[model samples]
Target: MPGPDYCDVDVLRRIRRRSLAALRADVEPVPPEVFAGFLPGWHEVGRLRGVDGVAAAVETLAGTPVAASALESLVLPARVVDYRPEYLDELTTSGEVVWIGAGASATGLEGWVALVPADAVADLAPDRRVEITELSQPARWILEIFAARPAGVGRFARELAPEVAARAGATAPPLPPPTPAEFAEAIWELAWAGFLSNDSLAPLRARLGGSAHPATLAAPATRATRATRAPRARSGLRSMRARRRIDAPSTTAPHLSGRWSLVPGAGEATARILGRSLALVDRDGVVLRGSVPEGLPGGFGSVYRVLARAEESGQVRRGYFVEGLGAAQFALPEAVERLRAAAAPAPGPPSGLVLAATDPAQAYGAALAWPEACGPGGHRPGRKIGACVALVAGRLVFYLERGGRSLLTFTTEPGVLAIAADALAEAIRAGRLGRITLTTIDGAAALTGAAATAALRGAGFVPHPRGLRLRGAMSRPESVSPAAETTAASGPGAGSGPGSGLESAGGCVDA
Candidate 1:
């Protein structure tokens, strides 16, 4: 069989669909061997040291020249992934030492006093496949970048490719097998790191090595950032925007190791795990008057300090950054999906349907309004009159007939107002109906009264004043007294009375 087709949109759509179906694939970094030749001054790890050595290596690796064998010492076991930092103060102010390792487990720190659970470095690995026989500061920086933003790794990798390629000179390797999973992992990391924008070099898809394109990178990152930030941002920005948007914050929007958003306007600001709060900075670089609350997992408490300084100067960026954290640390794809959906764009009204009537139908003639995404078999409830109290698909609709002649249908929800306005104007142009007069009624059941009027207008029923007078005279044929007429009106089966003509459709009777 041939290999998978390449395209950014296709990759994004496929991942989105697969993720929705619970069949998501994992992104793994390319092997070190594939790109070994490209990385100059690379070193290999020798033997595995215990947890203490690994921690020491982490503390000093940034400043010291790394040997090849140091990578082995940094490898994380799987067990450490289970421990999460609960109290913010313990890890930062307490001077408590946290273990950062290649394996997933925190066992190396067991029985060691002052030892606290730490984020696994392996959790930050990018999803792409590349060979590396040696190590360098840049590689370490790349690892840290992944740790901070697991979602953006793929895009970031593409960004770093030119730099890395430039550094490689004649030693640059061929394009490695950078699969979709790796691209996704890269994206996750980038998102975590506050690189919220997509920098996909489109029309140059072949350069990214995998089948992914640049456009695919745009929405997920934007959606993830919006979903993650909306709750906090909505309240802060409400006073600025002209229109007020209804915000639905995440309740089950996963709170993986990274901060997840909560519902908007629920009395929560940018929540910080530490006691300190983050100041809100708008897109225009203006900081809100009040300080915004910002939260961080225990290991990243130091980041808040940096952010606070930035906030004071009104230059603070509003996003989270985990220094050197990897993608696997808090793999909550489910939470990510929830946030994405919550932040997904709301669809516009369906095209081509006009609103003919609304509740309080008596006051207004046939007014047109925009039709909602409702009706029979339109996945909307309250399509029938008196269906339910709750507004489903905006409002209730009822079919009507005046004098037993079918008339136009109407929507009761106020969303139909704009629709009605536009549609009625069109009808007047087409000469379908006369001047449209819209009305409002208190309830869906009340619209039954206006049905007759709307039916007359729709069917162009010509009223005969003389004919009505004759019927009235017939009712009082022998000079019947008003008291007798009242008695005759009250005595009824299903004819011109409360329960009349509705027995086939669950008629009501007043005992």
Candidate 2:
């Protein structure tokens, strides 16, 4: 009987379809030739009659589930062979396309066509040598060129064109550099074989840098940069006034010069007097003395009340109202000392703190101290104490009130906060809490500056008119469960044991 016809067009189409599908799914598509060897009387066929015969044989067995499964399971060994330009040309002439499955922007066709000698392939890991190869003269020439310059083929070709010409020998015509398209193709092929180097593309990139599409080169302004520039345009007067206030020369302003000290007798009486004045003082204790600006709210009495409360809570250490400049000055010893330490030069990497306290009292104490320890100008002295502390990356990251309000957050190294935020986020997700909110005063601008705000933003905090808030990552429940809702509503550190408040209403208090 005549050997089974192996050149049927229908069989070729089916094989091609299956191969494409396999490739699309990232599964290695076995060449039809592998299956041809298993077919009955396959050896009887006169020769491997081009690609058609292999396809036909594979198609004939397609209907047989056992045969098809065998073919599907077959994994051909990947062999590395010398690169041959002729093979590529032949494949192209036959309307065959090779998918590179990698970026090929640089050395182009030259890298692909570069010869990988048998010895070179042998030197590689066995599994790395993906295709069996037949050597060709062109492949050898390209390999020699590449060997001459190990840095990259494109750079060698461009920067050392004369050397390449000398390598070609007197009788051989000067080797013309590959065109862009040819180079791209070579790069693609080389990349598929894992031989392409990004450095090799440097020369091409340098040459084409100016030629990139305008749209591709364009970059939008970053949010942080935009945020910094936004307020200037909308409130030029306010910006200028603020700048003047900070930069204005002062006489006998001890706080401005960072030379101020707490007055010996300054206490609750002094706090009452200074609070009434609503004075703005530098961290050093120099009060910005001047007439109260028009339209400024919160008279001295209201200010006094707040200061008295803070003093009673041990947040304010000392205060004074200077009649000479019509200004009030307050001293927070802890805050001032902290500022001084920050300015003092220190050797070695700064120390870091990471705490996870199970005792609510301890956690609360730390939370109260955080504002002074890490706040910008030192903590504002007094504010509502935090109820619970959130541990992020095993560190006490921030404290929250009973209502899920963020009272204070401790600063860490440059990138630590982001990590901690992510950890907290994971905890919230695991706990299935819908969300958490952090409340801060704009007056706390001294502590929570732009950088801290930006970091918080990265950690999924969004600024609302009220304050910065972060929502839970867990999906909202369809029907709110009463127990779960109550737990979430109670906030992070709602139920505290005894002695959760300040140990003594005396020294500096923060947060």
lDDT for 65 in candidate 1 is 14
Clashes of each: 78, 18
Which ranges in model 2 have alpha carbons more than 4 Å from their true place? 1-371, 376-386, 391-395, 432-434, 441-448, 473-511
lDDT of 2 by residue, 1-511 (tens): 7887767888886876665444324322222211111111221122334334333322222111111001111100001012222332233223231111112223221111111111122111111122314322333334455565533223322222223223333334634433333333333343334333222222222222222110111112222211122223345443333333222222112111111111111125444344333222211122222222112244444444554454444455333322222224333445334333433445763322211121111212311223343554322322121123444322345544333333456565546666655544543443222244443422242114455556666766554333444554433533435564354334323323222222322111111
CA lDDT, every model vs. true structure: 0.24, 0.30
TM-score computed on alpha carbons, candidate 2: 0.21
Write model 1 residue lDDT over 334-446, tens digit each, in one string.
Answer: 32232233233338862222221211111011111223422232122221211111111223232222111122334534444334333333322332222211111221111
lDDT of 2: 0.30
